[model samples]
Target: MEGFRLWPGALDAEAQSQLVQAVFGALGTAPLYRPQTPGGRPFSVQMSNLGPLGWVSDRGGYRYQPTHPVTGQAWPAIPQMLLDLWAATVGGKRAPDACLVNLYRDGAKMGLHQDRDEADLTAPVLSISLGDAAQFRIADGEGRTRTLRLTSGDVCALTGSARLARHGIDRVLEGSSRLIPGGGRLNLTLRIAR
Candidate 1:
């Protein structure tokens, strides 16, 4: 919690709508696909990426690549709005190299884990939430955990001491918002992978 920053409703409703459209547009090129764990178990959430690198998981292991796993095409560029958001929130000479996009629906949840695959752990990870709300959980150094309800337009970041902390979504609150045409939550995480 020492280095976690939360800007409630960072993006107003209109901005949220525009960002959603941009995300969908990018996904049109690199469609979302359910990823598998290294053990071959399927992940509950559908995932895709934007920027120079995309995070991927398969039988081989978790790593970053330049192309989509299913389409075999290069990922679309990171949305300009997100680039601006990163600049305003976590100012640095280098912008994030990856924006991992995740769609959660039907009780999809992610287990608590540290984001350590990136080469630079010092850079903060910025997360933008949209659609239905989610019970976001993160652990502190004392082994205690804190949970927050992340709704559409809400943005949070794990920086400094909290950058590599264990965090995840415990569950998504269904029917909370009507942003995503169908019912689901979209989480876009910006990270400096390399």
Candidate 2:
């Protein structure tokens, strides 16, 4: 009741599958790429974003914008399915200006970090877990930590005390779910980017 939420069959199965198709489809048109860190090393995972503003990371730094860097064109539009999920998941929250999409292949993991780049912490972060399930770990700024299994249709919203809290995907089990064709997980975090 406190840390996470379970939206049992929240996507009605069909919708979930459709969204996955849209995500992978867009990626095929514009594949996800590992951006270089400020220090000039490639980040471990590949990422991309959608909507009015797309989050980007590179040797320069992390920031948000309206176009894809590689394509020099507009980022793929945020699918309506994503918009609907955000509405239902956040309980009427407006459609996010930016949707950060992270693709995790089997065994891929993300380091713990606070999503502090967004302009306002008041607008909570809405995350939807699709494809395979993942072990999501949330660490309080105060040092306490808790991990939960965020599966398909699971909606995780970070707000209030936990807003801007440090968190990350510990690791994704290769074949945790059959929801998606590939043995991977797709996580989408919608936010109001400045």
Candidate 3:
């Protein structure tokens, strides 16, 4: 965790509840959809977004778009709590233009991958974990990996040398928390996607 920073319990119970509500509100407009890998394999996690740009993937490839792929409407604005979290944790004048909201239920695991689609690689990717705990794995280009338990309300940032590091969620510990109504994990990653 040399280049990564983790803040345990970054949001209290009430704050987490409010943030969950904001996510649901955004979902109403841009519903979550399962994305397929470039090779046509479906991803386990369903995804949506808030902010001007949203991260999406399909058989075409992974990229960012101004509008939701399903609805073809512009994505809702990033929640105020998320914007404030970015401003406080990342501490820069420029705010993140993309917020990728990933919903992972039981058995949903993201393969290790690097986040290099953004124009500015220097900007940190701030990830907010809600609901259940996930076994988050991070590694360098050499493939040395470390796994950490990311619980509800925890926040982590990948910045500087770790910005493009290989990372993914191995698995979510089911029934870890009741923060999510239907039982799942929600990961919100704020990024500068310009």
Candidate 4:
């Protein structure tokens, strides 16, 4: 929790299941899109964002904004369970205005990067992993490094020194669980992007 660790079932089973359903239900409204990197190469993982702000990347760069880049529509509201988990994990703190949902299909992996796009680095990032498991890598602000295997219903909070540290998923294991039909991983990261 302080440096880096996993919090399993941070959300109860009922809340977790409903959260997943809420997300997938909205997937049709604002479908996932694979944005190209700044260099014009498309990222391997397709993603979508919810809440007041959504995370996006393309030929321009990586950043957060109020409206969806494609439809110019406000992002879907952040599910109550997500906000509740953040509240339980970091109590009394204002809820994050942005929730970036990363959908990782088999063989899709995110590269290492620091989450500097937000206005305040002190705001802890609340991430939930559903459907399948993935290896999450974290490097310290200095020289320390560690690896964590995040499974379904697992949650992680990035705060204090780790808030600005570099992290990413190594890859999602295919056919790892029956939670999601295609054996994919759904990672919802909550952040105060404003």
Top model number, TM-score: 1
The segments of candidate 2 whose C-alpha lies over 4 angstroms from its true place after superposition are 1-9, 91-93
* Residue-level lDDT tens digits of model 1 in 63-89: 999999999999999999999999999
lDDT of each: 0.95, 0.79, 0.93, 0.82
**Count: clashes, candidate 2:** 0
Question: Model 4: residues >4 Å from true position, as ranges?
Answer: none
lDDT of model 2 at residue 11? 69
**TM-score for predicted model 4 compared with the true structure:** 0.93
lDDT of 4 at 179: 77
Residue 48 lDDT, candidate 4, scale 0-100: 88
Tens-digit lDDT track of model 2 for 85-135: 777667544668888888888477888888888888677788888878888
TM-score of each: 0.98, 0.90, 0.98, 0.93
What are the RMSDs of all candidates, in order?
0.7, 2.0, 0.8, 1.6
- Model 1 TM: 0.98
Give the range where candidate 1 is weakest over 10 consecutive residues by summed lDDT: 175-184
Cα lDDT tens digits, model 3, 1-194, are 56699999999999999999999988999999998899999899999999999999988888999999898999999988999999889878799999999999968989999999999899899999999999999997688999999999999999988988999999999999999979999999999999
Q: lDDT value for candidate 3? A: 0.93
